[model samples]
Target chain A: MITVALPKGSLLKDTIRMLQGAGLDFSGFLDSSNRQLQIVESSGRAQGLLVRAQDVPVYVEYGQAQLGIVGYDVLYEKEPNVAQLADLGFGSCRFSVATKKDGPYRSALDLPPHCRVASKFVHSARRYFQSIDLPVEIIPLSGSVELGPITGMSEAIVDLVSTGRTLKENNLMELEVLFESTARLVAHPLSYRLNVDNLSEYVDLIRQQVLVVA
Target chain B: MITVALPKGSLLKDTIRMLQGAGLDFSGFLDSSNRQLQIVESSGRAQGLLVRAQDVPVYVEYGQAQLGIVGYDVLYEKEPNVAQLADLGFGSCRFSVATKKDGPYRSALDLPPHCRVASKFVHSARRYFQSIDLPVEIIPLSGSVELGPITGMSEAIVDLVSTGRTLKENNLMELEVLFESTARLVAHPLSYRLNVDNLSEYVDLIRQQVLVVA
Candidate 1:
């Protein structure tokens, strides 16, 4: 039995649609109740675990689930031991370096030696700043990265800017784009080796569906 | 007027109780409408801003609000520019180091040179481990730190453990305790200075209430 972990919000609808297009029926999940955590498909050969977007990779990496659908930003931050198969072509966004519109920074290099950059993705934020040889203090925030600059808590912020509306509202501007992100189909090594036949069948079906949409 | 940023979770009830005990009537907050973000006390002298537990300090430090009620764990992690006035005495929990029941680590020192420890408080965990000279990696997870070690995505996790039930059920064990946390009344430095007369009155009232319980 192959278990698949799916993100619970935002990308959930599209994820389910793609799975259904691949002939994996999970209409029972439409119940919209707490009991829908586990969904049994029409074929009964696969099961889906609906979990938080961040927990999908954790489930798959621990072998609780053989495969997962998650964003590139999360994968980079977590550095989980999973094989990236293909981009599912939805939930596209960018992790960018942003600062107050009136700040001294005009580019990554313009950031001060000990400046602070706030973000929920602490790991990614730290690495990106360090890679640029810009010594920075990474102030970790759970959400509302825009508030960081507005409150003068950080010199800038490194966060995912989907439409830049949040940044604009807070008077922050994007300085540099770090990574263009989209959701990806990921698999665990053990699952790939052990359930090659069954996994490939499902993978091929999903891949063909994605190509059709493209 | 004194602005108070109140946590919107487990401690919200006690927070309101304390305010009422101080002779400030804020019963309007009990109505529980998500849209009612701000509420003015019946005294018409005090107002409340409903925010996430972790964001209490941010609002206070930015002078958006004068005082805040938040957990000690959050205070330790954010280390914002706020004076710890009184321990309000609710929403208590401990930031504990937990790992799989039969995992390699027997103690914090037993962790491998590069073993990853997942947590939402990346800075807090990093400082704690570094202060002890432990060469461990920190994998920041927004929530559900218990899922990290169980899923093999991290060697251990640093997270809040109130009853330890969640960790036990997930097959994880407490390896070490990092800090004891409780909700506290914190005030901004400038607010404490500028509104010393009124702020001291509010502080004294809360202090007396805490003493009665103590």
Candidate 2:
């Protein structure tokens, strides 16, 4: 079976829609039972594996799943050597550097060397600060990164700001946008090599639907 | 107010029991409709911040929450460097290295250098392999780590296995245990310093309850 990894939660809804638009009807997956972690498509040619949004790329990169739908933020952080075949055009958000509304960091360079910043995306944060010639101490936080700047543990935070309400409510302001994020369809290099013709057809179907929406 | 970070899901039930045992009662918290993320205790001197289990340490480490209840698995994986003042003595589990029941690996040394192993605890996996003089490629996966060995993406997996049922169902067997895990009560270093007497008293209450259980 040609296995695909789908991220759970908010992205799952849009991902299912995208798959349906691509002529891959996997409605049986809507059973809402925890036992249905893996599902078979109507055609039985493809199978879907539900995983955390952050781990989608790892599944595809390791060839456990031939393809995966994942957020751009995770892609930037993991930097897995996989084929970024197509953009799924949903789950949009922004990767931003945020600080307390009253803090000194107005720009990226305003952050002093050795200052501590908290983020789940450690690699992306390191690369961003390195590009600005400042070595930062990154306190890797799994979640609740907004609490970092609010409580004085970090000088700034790099996190996904969806509606900006969370940041505003916490008295935080966006200093700079690191990247605009959206979900993308990624494929394994070996998968593409082994099933080039079939995978290309599947990609074409999804791309046609995306172009229609565009 | 003294803010405490309470882990969401099953752990929350055990935490509430522990707090009640400590003579702190907040019955209103049981109301499911209380969308209010923050809640005040009856005493009005303490408050609770509901957050993900993985995020409990993040809140406490930043001092947004002076204290937190989280699993030892998350604590070891994140390594937040906070003070673990008490082990609440519930939510017991262990981090185990598992492989297919019929795979070649019977011990850590049986795996080849540079062989890939999948795990949610990347830091733990790296440290364990490094200590054994084995260089490895750690495939960081957030969930369903057992699938790694099943799909041939990794030769073994390091994950929190409460019972061996999941591994057995996946045709896998435990090779070695990395750590024994349980729920822990963590506190921020600066928060403890700022309110030494109050925090120490709170810690003593939890420690006493844990001793009773142990």
- Give the candidate number with the greatest lDDT: 2
Per-residue C-alpha lDDT of model 1 across residues A146-211, encoded as one tens digit per residue: 766765668889999898887777778999999999989999878877765489788888889889
Judge candidate 1 at residue B47 and give its lDDT: 82
The DockQ-based CAPRI class assigned to model 2 is medium
State the lDDT at B42 in candidate 2.
Answer: 84
Which residue pairs in model 1 clash with each other? Answer: none
lDDT (C-alpha) at residue A171 in model 1: 76
What stretches of model 1 exceed 4 Å from their correct place?
A102-105, B1-5, B13-51, B55-67, B72-85, B92-182, B187-200, B209-214
lDDT of 1 by residue, B7-88 (tens): 8778888888987888766666667564455677877888887767887887788676788889999889989999899887
Worst 10-residue lDDT window for candidate 2 chain A reads A27-36
lDDT of 2 by residue, A1-214 (tens): 6788888877888888888899886656556764566778878878888888888888888778888888888899989878898887889999999899988778978888898898989999999998888899998876777767755678999989889998988889999998899989899998787874388778778888788878
